[model samples]
Target: MKFTRRLFLGLAALLLGVGATMAHAANALDTIKQRKKILVAVDIGGPPYGMIDEQARQVGSDVEAARLLAQDLGVTLQIVPVSGPNRVPFLLSRKADVVMASFSITEDRKKVIDFSEPYGVVPVVIGGPASAKVASFADLSGKTIAVTRGTTSDQELTRGSKGIPSVSIVRYEDDATTNTAVATGQQDYIAAPPSTILAVKKASPSRDIASKFAMKAYPYGIGVRKNEPELKAWLDGWVKTNLKNGKLDEIYKRYFGMSLPPEVLQ
Candidate 1:
């Protein structure tokens, strides 16, 4: 049997393509195996999700979740405290292997990072003084709205509240500052995630603030590099396992003071 030169070249090219794909896959696996550590980016300012405690230790739902994930994978978890603005950049730069912050999955962010199956949902809320006449989003017109910088609350108030006129937006360095500003009348209202708002209210019973409005629910998930499909799949599998065995609910209640909502559990 005589092989034509053209056919020989085609076979060579095909073999090279397959070899390259295999090499790429192997390299990715090697990267994970060799390090034996998963770098997790978490917010140090968002309590009940990810935050730094008085002792300077990372502590919160996302932090605990990341620790469990690392334990399950038999790897060391290196927590890298990150601000909201830098979460995506850290993942892109390989400074972190995953983001376990309370990052709301958005179409815009999907362009930069891959999100695992949503592990929980956070409802948005508008908080203000109990004496305020504000009743809804419509009441926010011509009002000063305080929000943590680089958060989904900031994005939503800036983009979603288009119907409101003269809405002055105030950006704070962290959730605590944002909530405090509203409570102290430095801002008219604070747009924040419901869990954080509730936590703050609990911590400061004298604040006399009321969560007067609730908005669309935002799903929260872990983030990985956009190209790391395998890592994303593994994270989803872990979430499923935890949710099925009731561990997920336990974790939620421990941090948020409530069980996983039906929508999220289902």
Candidate 2:
């Protein structure tokens, strides 16, 4: 009886030790350490966020941010091209470690993934031909507006101008299509972030109809899996530190041609 009891106690102690070690090893940060690589999802179609450069290298604000984050984490950064609609699904499926796409935070999105603290703010604007008379958001009523289907600009126009009768929304699969639609006069106006619209206009100066509407500011954030609190905290700290140290401002100017607005710089 005594021998049996001693053996049972020994086995219980061994299991308890193993359980404690497993619990510690299962920590989010530790899991990342074990993997030694962070897979970042970036949109290949979105410029100024994530897109392929002439050299076929991924280049954009999100891509740069991921590279910096991975460097800070002492892990290799793996870029995964993801579409706007597949962002959350890819993260939830463990196909990516983080999403550095220019994702706007929304209540509906919060249900599936967690967003890092806001690192950038983009204003939705209505752009038309320079000769076109679109001075304000209300002016778009009864007009054909082009926008990317799954973007915040679309959501904003849908919610902000729902009361304006005759405002027809034309959805495009990507920004390039939306720009083409507006440039060709197939769409009367294009609703998008000022930075992106401005870039498009610069790329095609002949697209005489280019303007932006004044709307609420849309903050952009990095995304991670819902339960990855440690990673979230790390990313938030990384952004805060970079912003305070002026690195973030430099990045903003490199991509957007100017420093971030004071509100966003903070």
Candidate 3:
């Protein structure tokens, strides 16, 4: 009888310990409320998504979206500028509460982190000087393509160019550097989103860059750390409200000069 009683007592203690662990687990929403700020990671390297304005201040679609999130949550917004490759790592390392870095939603990324419903869409494309004849993936043979590491463009180019042994894929750390390669003539072709290609043209007007072909368009979402149901749910609802109210589209049009994809709006 005493042994059974001790066993029961041990089980009860374990249950209490488990309960405590669960209670102490981090809930990002509550933490944000407690701290009165939401740290959002953004990549200013990419323009129209995130970039610097004439006043040297951060301004772009992603930047405005982050502000909206903080405004609606009643928290101060702290933008943590990051490179494209480090967006997920920053969130996982707790350096940022969320990632608003034009983060493309992908099956591979969803395996590690959680994403809110898509708020915007960006089309990936292969762009080069107007003189380059690269209308299709097959035409990439014997040409070099620059891409930002860890981006969908990089992945698509790498995968699609495997059959073309002569195609050389050069990877840069961020969109800014990738675009620079094209502007300076260090590389003739770039795999990036259309907005980034447009920024490249705007920066180097003499270069006469143009999109050669369109790849798949990807929907982007707010990235939250896994297991933060409260934060994820709140973000989902916030996205829905803003998307429905046309605020998200408004921000997109301001930067992209076009409406959000019809599918994303639905």
Candidate 4:
């Protein structure tokens, strides 16, 4: 009887040890704190959200937001550059602690990863040079549209052009390439956020690129891996605090030249 009791006690102790180890491994916030650094993924190629300034420094709304997060956490910030297609993959693979690369909150993305409260909004649009007939989907019957692969813009465009059989859709690996395709006249139109369309205009000033139609605006969120309740909760609180204090608005205005939506502010 004593031997059986001894064996039971040993088993209980082993179980407790295993449980503790699992809990420790799951708490990413603690691990970040212990490491004194947070790895944030940003798409540096996308301007206004993530970009390199003339001074050769990363300066963009998402980069600033990541910096603020690291500052509040009392940890150093290490940016992991990524593209639209790899944003979720990087987070799931543990290559990044958080993703702030203008990541839009979508029903489909939510199925794979968790997103914090939205920090900003992106107005997606279909844009082309002034001469291109792109006032509506019907106008795009014979035109080619370029979009970044795996981005919300691509999904929205695909859904919006369902019946436009003559419209050709071309996918690029990143926002820069997608915008460049339209900027250089390789594609007749580009389905992208307004900020990126503006970038396309700047890249080819002679083209007079402008948005032909609005394609719905989506709120941007910070992405974290699934099953990270603690980390996600902390981010949610942080978003609320920043939104109320005007800091997030300040960053938004700095890049977007506008205030956040009323619903988002509340």
Candidate achieving the largest TM-score:
4
* Model 2 per-residue lDDT tens digits across residues 122-194: 7777777788677766777778888888778888888878788788998987777776776666876778877
Worst-scoring 10-residue span by lDDT in model 1: 24-33
Whole-model Cα lDDT of every candidate shown, in order = 0.80, 0.80, 0.91, 0.91
Better of 3 and 4 by lDDT: 4
lDDT of 1 by residue, 1-266 (tens): 25688899999999999999887774533476578988889887777788778898878888888888889888888998887778888888888888998888988888877898888777777877678788767788878888888778888777767868877888987776886776566775788887666766666667766787776678889988866666777888998888888887788899877887787777
Q: What are the RMSDs of all candidates, in order?
A: 3.3, 3.1, 1.9, 1.1
TM-score of each: 0.86, 0.85, 0.94, 0.97
TM-score of 4: 0.97
The alpha-carbon lDDT assigned to residue 151 of candidate 4 equals 94
Candidate whose lDDT is highest? 4
Model 2 weakest lDDT span, ten residues long: 207-216
- Candidate 2, lDDT over the whole model: 0.80
Tell me the tens digit of each residue's lDDT in model 4 across 17-118. Answer: 999999988999999999999999999999899999899999999999999999998999999999999999999999999999999999999999999999
Better of 1 and 3 by lDDT: 3
List residue ranges in candidate 1 displaced over 4 A.
1-30, 173-180, 183-185, 199-206
